[model samples]
Target: MSGFACASSCGLIFKSKESERNVVSLFQYDGLRAVESIRLGAIRCDPKSSISTSAAKCGRIKAMASPTVSAPKREKDPKKRIVITGMGLVSVFGNDIDMFYNKLLEGVSGISPIDRFDASEFSVRFAGQIRNFSSKGYIDGKNDRRLDDCWRYCLVAGKRALEDASLGQEVLETMDRTRIGVLVGSGMGGITAFSNGVEALIQKGYKKITPFFIPYSITNMGSALLAIDTGLMGPNYSISTACATANYCFYAAANHIRRGEADIMVAGGTEAAVIPTGVGGFIACRALSQRNDEPERASRPWDKDRDGFVIGEGSGVLIMESLEHATKRGANIIAEYLGGAVTCDAHHMTDPRSDGLGVSSCIIKSLEDAGVAPEEVNYVNAHATSTLAGDLAEVNAIKKVFKNTSEIKMNGTKSMTGHGLGAAGGLEAIATIKAITTGWLHPTINQHNLEPEVTIDTVPNVKKQHEVNVGISNSFGFGGHNSVVAFAPFKP
Candidate 1:
């Protein structure tokens, strides 16, 4: 028997002479191709066989063909479901998830002057800075100075998530640690560390730079450090799709569970790029709000006088477990992760498709993947970063997907927490979970007047208490990356 392999953009497919057997494998790399070579001493096939002719048509096929190997068939186990067990967040609004939720419900704004570093000379000054986060409590004494701000945030958030899930060390010790995983992301990784490291390298020789510089600056270190701190040994990686970083991380983590690679995963995002360089770069691009006099009202998404987003720093982590695993351990399921979808605009590096074609497709795909109808969506957490074009594009997309339901309750959490960049998705996901669990929808504060172009009924001022069985969170970023996630109250 002869075997053939074909590679496509999505995956690789291998077909055997025995037509009944075939294997398909999804690949992360886009440039996958099939390479064929013959083994001289391998099993010889009849020269006149159809398999031999098939081998001749292709470049070359290995003579050896062990009984056609097939990939394990995916079983539709209705008993197994994916749910959110625990959530932890360190946002500019607060340190704990409950504090953040309460502030959101009260329509409090966290934007303020850039206090981390002097930004007086910059065009933009306000940002969402985590006020009272202390690294000493989360990081080890010896490693505190070596870690970056993003890692510090992830460590704290990850620990809190584990504790909230009641997965103490004693419990983890009994479970298969190898079956647990971590997927954390950051848009700018360690911009502060990178900037400082470069300055040190320029001032002194190579020896002057600390050995931890590279490890602290790379994006994956957040996930790596979380795994080390939490003793999780499953699939671990970090995604960087500009501001869509965390949403991609959640999507990837869910696939890991769906593919049976892990039973429980610690997945989310962390971002601490609120330094001088970080702020100045966005200011240069004119992508930051310049309402310095009234920083609180600067991030007015869908408002007529909206300027741009206020850079925010923090982390949000979620503990996701298979329903089977959570039930086996009697874990408290916070919400069910219905599913999510991601798409690229392929239009612009920083701007979204003018008509929001990409965003609409992503939302529709996410709803389809989650098997939820649009009318059933009770609330929407928008990616309205207060930018003019980006906000309108998203609004247009929401209208196209939700249709007459565009009047549904929608809120821009970024109005409260500022734009967390890569961490926005995870943080917003936590907000959505809280909305469903508490029956409260956070408000889009700071909108003094609605923009004429915006037709949706955006909830402003105080939060609204209502039954929200299903919620959708939208996150779009630079590079035209669009991601949408759906969450629902866990009925079971």
Candidate 2:
């Protein structure tokens, strides 16, 4: 049997004798020559190659003009791997990562009555108000006082994340500072400053506005200030896509490494919008929950009794480094940032598209970019904001792409932290990565009644033990901006 030639695929057997040499020799011929050679008789095929079943009837092997199987070879990525080494955030829960996640794990609500100002007249009087906030170590006291809370949040979060990644001033001095970058941003940058400036201008005239007003009130200042502080000469800027701002910054920052542009990036979002103006604007749009009576139970995504989102305020920043750079520095890696994608609904200003096409496509593209299969993702950090239209729309979009029905478990972390506006993605990304590291899914606190639209398990009310090898965090904005980031537990 070993001496005999065979077409294992088509089950054709040919003897190794000289009488069958015509068939054995054809295996080495070019496609056309093979076809001609096979016509002589006793067709044989290499065991490694496939032969059509029609060979029995035709008594000959077909040949091709080309050498390959027809698909074009994919070019390999030559750049370094991008990873999340450290993350830092100031949330209503706390500044510590363990404290922030443990609170959510216990299913505790961070939402409370807005303590930053008198929100009594506003329709929504409560929020995830950040408390005992200070930027003393991260920013100079004089500069901290001069800048708006948004800038302070950005600087504090950015510096803290760098320190967490061991890229502090001392470590940075030893490396190429120009190869690092910053991309922190806020949806409504310096809203507090802008609101105060406007109020002063209206009451006492333009002269009442401070000289530092314009520089501090712009949307780009968050990224600008971080770059100025870190001296990162590489790609540095802020991108505003409302709530999707964090994911957008993350996506762009990862690409900067993948494209060989930067070795490290400080990316994510920060915002302090618990003020009178921020709450008032959302109240005017009726986008805030009216469940002021029970502040703890307000931000209930996928709940039948849910009304709207509870406004959350704070900052979440991450230090992203190319694997080469992080490995060389011997940094502690937290997670692997696999891939991400962005899409626009282009249907409405503040409403999502009814068809759910934008979000579905975005998820598919993100998975494709990550080289991940849909079934491989056992966990999903939903973007459900507790709004009537928004929550269901996201559920439907998720349903469209994930068809395993019950294998995937989705959770609404907003049910605890509320919606963090532009910083939501950053906050949620941390939650997702923590789940990957801890093997625990933080519960959706206020899910008293799950909606029919949610067929996937929400892991409601209490923390559940689950393995999170791969996961995604979703973030969508009022302007129909949809962004998703794919991540996994660090393996190398």
lDDT of each: 0.74, 0.76
Give the poorly placed runs of model 2, Cα more than 4 Å off.
1-78
Model 1: how far is 169 from its true place, Å? Answer: 2.0
Candidate 1 residue pairs that clash? none
lDDT of 2 by residue, 283-310 (tens): 6655678898999999898898987788
The TM-score that candidate 1 achieves is 0.83
Error of 2 at 187 (Å): 0.6
lDDT of 2 at 280: 78
Per-model TM against the reference = 0.83, 0.84
* Candidate 1, 230-259: lDDT as tens digits: 688999999887777787888888888888
Q: How accurate is candidate 2 locally (lDDT)?
A: 0.76
